[model samples]
Target: MVLYTLAPGIRLSFNEIYTSSWEKGDSSIFGERMLIVNFCIHGRCDVSLAKNRYAIVKENQVCISTVMPTKDFYYPRSLYEGIQLYLDLDILHDENGQDFLSALGISLEQIVEIFCEKDGLYLHQMNDTLRTLVKDAWDGKDDIEIGTLRYLAVRLLHEIMSMPAESETETYFTRSQIAMVKEAETLILSDLTTRITAKELADRFGVSESSFKFYVKGILGDSYLNYFRKKRMEKAAELLETTNLKVIEIASAVGYENQGKFAKVFADTYGVSPLEFRRLSK
Candidate 1:
């Protein structure tokens, strides 16, 4: 993957590969505060963010609005590749921000609330103009790339924030509920290597252990430990495929103390020994 900072508060990143499938890899935790918008330009890949997993992103499709400290993977990968744009919300405090939001018919108050709530993993229906802008970003247009991406980003955000609350009434997870989950997810990811117990997580959210587990299971369909392991394993897999790091080294990096246990878990999840997986991947 190659990352380019297109402007002061915006960036473009992408990777192109020709392969039957992507070897299982580790999830990436975003440390900086920014909103990420990803466009799958060429092929398909599964992206797991927060507690939710996106299985297939095809050409011209987009995944928008994820906060930092999230996990993701690309799956059943066939020459899978795409571009990601990161935008700093602070930029919206200025005239450009106002103009952009105004054009999308979103109010300043709504934007503030959305940011305060820290929403995650929002997918928007794409229109022709939005689709074309994403293509332009991937094509590396020098003259208008940054402006186009920023414009599209704001437009998409407005569309999401402006939708009638009633329209989402049937959704199992409300906007507030989604925001809370994302907040919990962010806390969990902030320190992936640390030992975080259920009690601690519940305390942080001011909820009972049962409630926390229920929320996690209800939205993510898994317990907290299972979700964390998936994220760690996903990150470990990415390192194995992209680097020449030793197995022991990779194990330690992903928070494993016993190499034997790490290898066992990795093999079970991936259906191959770590060494074998690495060799075949290359």
Candidate 2:
């Protein structure tokens, strides 16, 4: 795949047709609020979002995600090819911010509703006509002029802004609770070798132990113990696949004192023993 800056605050990433599926870690973290449109011109892929949400984009389909901090990955299957258009809000703000919104038939209230008021990922599927237009633009991305690309982006976004807001799940966590949950995730994952208990996490975050657990469950949709176990398993798997450490050492690295228990959990999680997994990965 290749990424090209078609214009300021606008970029296109595409790849030549390939028989094998596209698979890689996409750790591109956007700093500010931005609009992104993804066009699956020639393949199907699964996108992973935080908090256990996922979106699947298929051939000839388009998906839009509004302003938010994003950390995601795409796993494509088959002749995987696609283009992503990034619209930076700062550049689009212009001299008078209202002018840009007016030109696109979007209002400040609507922007807030779709981008800020919402929780989790704000993604919506485009109608078929808009989908075709997006696909056409992406298919010709390599040859399209900058002006034409900008025009296409605006047109696509106008339609996207007009779509109905996605229904939101009832979130029980307040803003502070949500922030604490994020902090908790960082702290837990920060040290893999230490088993940090829920009480310890609550103490560190300065929240009551029960309240901390409640907020974490609300945000992650999993209990603290379950979530902690999952993270440790993920670390163990990464170590097994990427390092030359022995199984016992790997077990110790991820907070498991007993190698036998570690092997059993690894097998349950990955359907293979750690040694076999290492061999297969290689």
Candidate 3:
């Protein structure tokens, strides 16, 4: 387990877990009253709350739980890997934070209801935007500093409370199906030079074309082509900022055959052309 204390009210933990079969532990939530968001980046685990009551947090899923200072929660761990955040919601009452939350359509009472009241453990598959944001939070990428993390935690609360009802796709998907989707993602990110089609990926993974597309859409919150292009564009930007590669070389590296088209997309994504980005970075 790796931990980061970004502030007094916010702490982040990234756990690379390998426990004995059926290992058990007492979660310190019994003594802490805070909002917790756990992202199961890989693997899964079951959390036992009260007698004969439990919640299973699946892989690639996220959960929000509110802890009571006097309640005991048991974790009968299987192999678990995840990133978790501890957020002291009381911090929001300071200054104009509550007002800021209200502007975002969230109120302290609502937050309390979602995080402090009821059974209080909620789980859902993250939409692509939130998925990426959580990953950035773990990777310490993009400007996810202490202040940004606080903002993200608040935004996360908004998302959790506002998410729509579960669809059939979310309600049921086998581990094999999840693995197929992850394999497809691996293939997409494997080679930036090659143009990979959804059909080709489906065929490679032995899944039907439509089902593969649907699964990718459900997990990534975008069409496969759109997501792939976004990743490629991000790669192009990295090359521009870190290397002395020419525009044509960068474009080619990102699977763009036409430099002009690449320039247009890059400008749209970064508000400047590739050369300008490079110059600014330097």
Of the candidates shown, which would achieve the greatest lDDT relative to the real structure?
A: 3
- Using all chains and alpha carbons, the TM-scores for the candidates as numbered come to 0.40, 0.50, 0.49
Regions of model 3 farther than 4 Å from truth: 1-121, 124-172
Q: How accurate is candidate 1 locally (lDDT)?
A: 0.59
Tell me how far the alpha carbon of residue 23 in candidate 2 is from the true structure, in angstroms, after superposition.
26
lDDT of each residue in 99-144, candidate 3, tens digit only:
4445556564565575446566667787876777667766764345
Candidate 3 has which clashing residue pairs, if any?
A: none
Better of 1 and 3 by TM-score: 3
RMSD (CA, Å), each prediction: 11.7, 9.7, 11.7
lDDT of 2 by residue, 63-148 (tens): 55553423333332224566676656565565345444355564534554574465534444557867777778766766877667
Could you arrange the candidates by TM-score from highest to lowest? 2, 3, 1
lDDT of all predictions: 0.59, 0.64, 0.65
